[model samples]
Target: MKVAVSVLGLAAIAAAHGYHEEDQTPIEGPHNALWYNTLPGDGGTQADSVFSGISTFGRIQYHPCLTSRSVKYDIAFIGAPFDTGTSYRPGARFGPSGIRQGSRRLNLYLPLCSRRVGFSGGYNVPLKANPFNSWAKVIDCGDIPVTSYDNGYALQQIEDGHNLLLSRAPYTDADKPGPAKKDRTLPRLITLGGDHTITLPLLRSINREYGPVSVIHFDSHLDTWKPKVFGGSPSQQASINHGTYFFHAAQEGLLANDSNIHAGIRTTLSGPSDYENDGYCGFQIVEAREIDKIGTDGIIKKIRERVGTEKPVYLSIDIDTLDPAFAPATGTPETGGWTTRELRTIIRGLEGINLIAADIVEVAPAYDTNAELTTMAAADTLYEVMTLMVKKGPLSGMKEKEERLELKA
Candidate 1:
């Protein structure tokens, strides 16, 4: 009797809302009109509020570039959610999602005054341009599926995912004239890393296309430590870690000699010999305190002179490069690092350099504060990178390399 009374009560509640078992569909009412959804759909418009949609990097449109051959994109944001290579901390696997969540306000609605002036896309006042409004077809490719149990498999997955995007033809619109002249142009990838170790596989994938590109590594530690000094293991796979991945990269010929550089380094090395070994691994150091003596422009000049403008360059940014006060949620936080604003200015100063690919890693959001400072810094730095790519357009070396191969044939 009690169960029957409960069923009757549910039926009464449903009847109050005008429900019928046979209808099976919503009844059209004034409140149920489609016109209520004045916000923009996923068709790439700024009508929706920043808080009201699926989270993507800067609320950009998402496409599965790995599985779809028809999908065209010039610059794709991919997430590498593996952090097994971390030595000190282990929560960087969550870095990718954390960075995305912090990027909610990046491309929000335009300002009232700017809208009156006939501006449409989201704008960065410092950059003086809107990357989303640029000609490069940009999309978020989601995250790479990596297994956490085995480091080797996870690293291989990163390399494969990066290579797949690199193999796709760049999206081009005939109405909008871009920097690429070739019919078959490769796309640039902006990777959200799981850890600093992820750079090894990324560089390996980049080597297949650009052939040992110069690396502009921004970190607080000299990641080029030899395996013996970093750590040793019986298993060869276990030996390749975040602190020693650059040594492996050098061994595999994935780095261009005399062109790579490390900026903002201030870690206490094992000894002075570590610096000598670092030089042997092909990286010139720019200490963290050099900013006081030379300033940002001076450091930028040094990096520009090191990598130059002709060869392909890969940028690897470890979030620990920023001081802990600015970004505390990293696997390896070092004191006396650069500020977020200073890093943005330095990245913007690198405009017109041949940046083929880039990654920002080591953002372990578990250690972050309530303000989400670390993730916000990583996202805004990524914004600067995207803006830099838009300002420079596509790499011209893609056409030149293909022509060289054709000549050999």
Candidate 2:
């Protein structure tokens, strides 16, 4: 009787939640939801069909499920909407929504109609190149339901949610390998930010998968300040904060500090100890002004040298890494930053960094202008990350030497 009742209850719940598509097509996509979804149901305006088809990235479908029994996922995009950790500004809670909204207006193809830089296809239905199939399964898992009434609980919830995704299998049986293996091999996580503080919890979850991964952080601030909670300060107790989580993560052995590096740092220091604090936390600094001296290729060479192709890596991009002229909607804006194209080229140069996971953070839409360049840059940056994950080979020769080894093997 209990088993029968349980089945009935589950069936009822699924029925209540299922989309009752009467004549809706069962399939769509060149990029999984691309071409077929464009025409959605017959007899609608172009605008209507575009918006109504798929509500996620560039008309991609929204998929909120993350269970072993469900279809495996290669990449899962989700949002973290809590920004109580912000020290200077607080509107980043809207970052994820802003990014998604901006992405809908952007095309998925390399140049909207060519595959020279990316995949070959028209703007509406983008295709992928050889070995990096456009058919790769990416699911938008939706936002973590963080209400922010309790900060600690909210942080833990984010960590738990991330761990849950990392622990599951990708949709392909080949990706999973063995039926007995509890977790899949190559599925990755792309997170849209609540704030930089989310990185600490995210790293904690990832540590369980590949211990102490080297980090390639692109930010305008060092983010290694010590929290007031340390040393048992007589003032009110402090918690893990955006400005201080990297310090804690390093102290807790959560990062391969010696191998980690920060790019585009230009924030004013509180004291001489600020740079020292960052050094102690285990990161090499690449100042924003250094870009002019070293140029894009120099910066790429330095990053590849610091985070060699051997170890697993994580990329944390704060929107402020781009100059305010390019991305002005971040909470902590800093001057003298890289251009969006420069950043894109640098990221592209890191084709074989063994990137395990990544997140684009600190995009506050409230501060943006009607142009929406800040959020749009964040969306474009996310696209660069996806390309980095799914690319086949270098554009020309002069590839990283380690890649030659990979090809030979």
Candidate 3:
């Protein structure tokens, strides 16, 4: 009798719902004029039919979701199409397209539950009055326009292009009279990778505008090696090279102090000298072995102590941080590293903290055969981070307690 009532209730609800043609489109509603419109019914204004047809690419509407009101967006998916900083393979430039292609296979639902939640439970949530109703607004703001060569200039161009997309308020003559106050207002820009080096300029821009920002760097190497190959040239292989981004960031005064950066460093190939005299000054390093010892909880606690509760945090993930068994196609793969589950735990633990911006770097698809592991992991990680951003108001420890109760139940 209860089962029959449930079926009848579901049928009644379905009958009462009015299904519109726009509901079938990827982007389903009104948005800011500047956002990309990929929904099939969007009247071909923003993206061409071919680009709009793919689910991975969608329109961005400007509105308040997490941050303040200033060109606010649900989410912006950007592609960084270059890899000049790679030390081994020369194919990470293709990473953005490959990852996007792989992302197309993702269902617009959390993998754990079949409900629509936008690439895992990262964006969809229930309204207070209606638990059954879930909504999410996401956009593919298009790729970070980049060239194939002149990496130094390319990095600058990528940063400028991203800035243009991220810029909310244009400066008019009236607004330009006084010195521009550091505008803390910007979109929660979620960037895809050309290589890990691409993160350098983005981080710089974020820090310049928002002041001191905490960092959660997930990678195999420390990326703290001072660039010696390019002889101080402004090439991507110089200060912003994949291997030396954080090192230079610290040197350039982007990170506040040692305590502001938490290097979730797993695999390593550097000598002892790399640690003693590296430019990372006093940054904290969480080795994989230590993570095995103290557990993810302990690592989270340590990160909290270092980064503190107040500052806005940035998460930069180099896909190579995962063990080769899990992410083998990355340009730099290390044997001993976090598993996918372990990595997820670390991200899940950081919930409720101020996540200002994030990026997933170093996904070299040219080396990937099945396209199963690296890109999937990238998508999952991106989902988890974005979800944390949306639900940032909730306390981290409180969420953990609730999870424990659910498990017991």
Candidate 4:
């Protein structure tokens, strides 16, 4: 995937030399203070260009806990902060904090022009112009608070929080009596993630609101295994377990078209007939070797065709989808898998599609060293998605300007 460069001219200069400087400015101001560090100097045109009058990065203002409307954002960043569903390494619950701490260093202003052309030998195209200049808004609502002991309750809380954001509450008549009533748009929930299973509840809530949602699930395992069957009633235990999310989703009628739920499944452990029957049930299964054979563009095209352009898409990325060489510490690292670049290419290709929400899950920081690869990859992916959102409009304006400049030349 082509990594879009940050707009700060100074960082461009610094990056040329392979060093990322940490900006130490306090974040108590209106916008994130780290953004100011990307400037050419302490005070420069680059700094002014990226941070001028931008009160916040995304929906998250500095010191979010102190804010009254806790859910104040077009996009909310809730953390599941749990890994109880993992069939393997038990530390993915720490993923949210680790990713957050690592991501705090990001400036969040991606200049579309910085994207490298011909990244996939012309398979991928750069945005026609820079979108950051167009003023699209995003907010980082605080992470969802999860209790350590009760996984089921924690999952319910996550669903409740997302529902609050998704539900449109009436504007208080006491504040402003209205002969005129306007429906407030609910925030688009972007979860930081606890485990892959955390997605089940989030998906359930989304399905309730919008009907079946098309899922683009990226993972090493099939996650379609049926949890061990118990007497009479199906156990809720298996319903929300990490490995069985997709299976449960399918069984529960949460998926619009089973084919729309493309599973980029590479690794696996065999269990029941249901697990093996995923491909039969309409999932567009793209195995690891298939990704290697056809490349990112092929897989992206397949996804686009299956999901279609108009449908609201939900992206769920399990950190283990990446090759262990690049993201070694994920709960279930497969030996061979897609490179981080490949994943980015696939994500970038979905630029114009209606992406309602996304999440990066199952990152176990305890298994990582330096936390360098996973952090960098996760942050870059978020930037790419945000840029995609911007490029759909404001960023396109910049592209138009670039075209005019080229014509003049």
Candidate 5:
């Protein structure tokens, strides 16, 4: 009788605590169930919570763009998880996952005063837009299945994987017109890369879709090094490293002649002839020191003049483009590079250019601080890139703050 009374008392306490053993009760009213239990695009899979659900770039919806032919996206965040091409650091193979993890706080629906506020997808005040909330259908397509044993095979995998995603027709939207290359309205890929070498394969893949596209290469090193100068001869694998991939790309006729530009270059070269060789590969250099002499707007103007606003441009950013103080976790750590703000400002200035595809590469999270500074910087830089894309093309019809302020004036 005492045990039975104890059990009844426990049941009463459980009830008081709002515990239900046989509870299959449907959630009622305007509660968190709408945010937690529903799928993405409905209420979202609670990925917006930042602490919950699968980690994707910006907590965006995930789609198997590589495996499924039916899945279409206007902007797909694909990962190239191959870092065997790195000469100085090896941990960048984990860059794709690290970048995604760092991007968790992005695209969040804020919870305030124990109540969900008006739906806002992590707005960018400077750009006056939220890319996640934009009309473009953006999704994280996950990482490429790249091999680690052989660099040659791994590069091919990256090429094929990028091509697979790039070839897919974009999700149809009226306000978001897909960038056109050869009469086909194709999707854009914002790639999270393993290392700088991945850009070569990506360029090869993009060349198929858009032909010889102009390149906006951002790094502390000129990647257009000759095979023999960087590493080669005995092993061909040694030739096509992160330092020399752009050389291969140029040789393959994948780059637009005289239209490609490399900004933030500060690496110690073999000689002045290296710059000549870089010119032969069709890339104009904007040295890192130029930032001090000319400033961000000047650098932006130079890039705009070089690549032009008309042609399809591939934007490739190595994390080392930022100073080691800002982004220390990279294959190559160059001290005197642009700050994240300067880089973002330059990227934002390229608002009117035709950007077909882009990648943020060489983010080795293993070398990052406990705060994940490098990883966060990389993700935020990509966010800026995404904003640029969101504002361009058909979406450019929207008026900017400058335009609105001018009207008031």
Candidate 6:
């Protein structure tokens, strides 16, 4: 009886621990398979997550504490998850979190590529710059802690949050030469947006620093249509919708007129009023189809020439700028857009420019599939912009006029 009982117990144990069908190998032991770092918190009330068995991007060695204030930050990776202003779709409020989830695993290898990518072949061949793999002082400052329910209040909160980050001192001065590393040292903001509307608050923050910087906008839509054009009361002229914020921006003298340019635009307009608004804002339009004609090099040349080597630039990317085939998870995704590779290459060509601040927005993850394609694209775009911030000036031929025109905050 005892022998029979022991035989049954072994069978039950083996049944509980399944085996691989291919080779009939048992799964690894519990300790071997266990992951996640867990520790006791202060006073032993809760447990702190210091180190897990597996890789954790949030707790990566170089990442600073979210509450850290004394240490000067070169860039604060902030999330503004507000999608209140979307015209057609509305899942963008989850963009920041989706992006974070997609980029949870970080290393030198390209997530989509077969080999490691960094500072290698230029646009024609293309390469992904893995800045996070370096000693970049990047910290996930968490989200903007935005409140839902009210549109006006949300914008106010978002603006206030950015203002506080902007107000922090002891940040790197990337423009200073000699002792400090010019581009690496200067303080900057890289926002993982709630939606395109977040740019208005960001621009408002940057305008306080650069006093109306030029804009390098990458989007499938012009986004300069008037509030009424989008259908609203004239009294709602001051209203701040994602589609109409740029119009308000132009109205408020927040953008450097004639220095702003839009790339990848394919959205249909309401006629002459659209041109009038764009003209009023002094924006040069580079239609999406023009990419085939200009190629990446020509596009870079145009952007360089449009914004020039000098003057502060605010780079804004609405993920819908890429073809829905590559990024279908956006709210108002326009078809016939640039491919992920094309978009990444184009952004790479924009290296070594005088970039002051930047943002990547409109990543509505609800429509995204389990694969997380759109969120990953937004994350990749953020990495490219971070590299651009890293690869700033004293260009090959750093002209004196160019130096003078380069505004420092």
Which candidate's TM-score is highest?
5
Q: What is candidate 6's lDDT per residue for 1-409, written digit by digit as tens?
A: 6644654555455446542123232112124233221212201111122222232223223333235556556566778889888878898888887887665443321111111111111112233343543334555666677877777778877877776665554244334431112322235677887889888888877765557778999999888877876647345523678888888789888898898899998887767667666788779988889988878788778888899855667899999999999999998988889999888888988876777668889999999988999988887777677767655532212333444556642
Taking all chains together, each candidate's TM-score versus the true structure is 0.83, 0.77, 0.71, 0.71, 0.84, 0.74
The local lDDT score (0 to 100) that residue 12 gets in candidate 4 is: 62
**Model 4 segments beyond 4 Å from truth?**
1-71, 108-125, 128-134, 168-185, 229-235, 269-276, 279-282, 393-409
lDDT of 5 by residue, 1-409 (tens): 6644655565566567554544312212234455542112334222234576688998888988788989988789999988888778888989999999888877665432111122335667788777886778899999989989998999999999999888867774423333345356677899998999999999999988778989999999998888887766358888998999988898999998999899999999767887887788888899999999899999999999999876678999999999999998999898999999999898888888888899999999999999999999999999999988887843223223234556989
User: For residues 70-131, could you state the per-residue lDDT of candidate 2 as single tens digits?
Assistant: 64566778888878888788888899888987776544332121111122121211223322
Cα lDDT computed for each candidate against the true fold: 0.81, 0.71, 0.61, 0.61, 0.81, 0.67
Candidate 1 lDDT, 143-216, residue by residue in tens = 98889999999999999989988766778532332223333356789999899999999998987766777999
- For model 3, residues 1-409, the per-residue Cα lDDT tens digits are 6644654554455346532223322322222353442222334222222234443522223232223324434346777787888877667777776666665434332211111111221232221111012232355665766887687788887777666655543212212211112422344578889888888888767655566566877877777776763236465445567877777777777776766544456545446666565434557777767787898888778777877655567788888878888887798788787888788777777765767678888888877767468877787677677666556532233334445667999
Instruction: Show model 5 residue runs off by greater than 4 Å.
Output: 1-48, 112-116, 173-181, 394-409
Model 1: runs farther than 4 Å from truth?
1-46, 110-121, 173-184, 397-409
How high a TM-score does candidate 1 get? 0.83
lDDT of 4 by residue, 1-409 (tens): 1222434454466467543333212122333443333323332122222334433323134334213444344344666777887767788777776676555434534332322210101001354423222334455556667776777888887777666655432211212221112312233556777788888888878776666778888887777665663112266764567877777788888776764654456664445554457664347667777886788888888888888755566788887888888887788778778888888788888877766677888888888878567855765566566666555442223334445667999
**Model 6 off-target regions past 4 Å?**
1-68, 108-130, 133-136, 170-186, 234-238, 393-409
- Per-residue error (Å), model 5, residue 323: 0.5
**Candidate 1 Cα deviation (angstroms), residue 380:** 0.4
Clashing pairs in 5: none
What does the lDDT read for residue 122 in candidate 2?
16
Question: Where does candidate 2 clash, by residue pair?
Answer: 29-34, 72-170, 72-171, 73-171
Best of the two (4, 6) by lDDT:
6
lDDT for residue 140 in candidate 2, whole number 0-100: 79
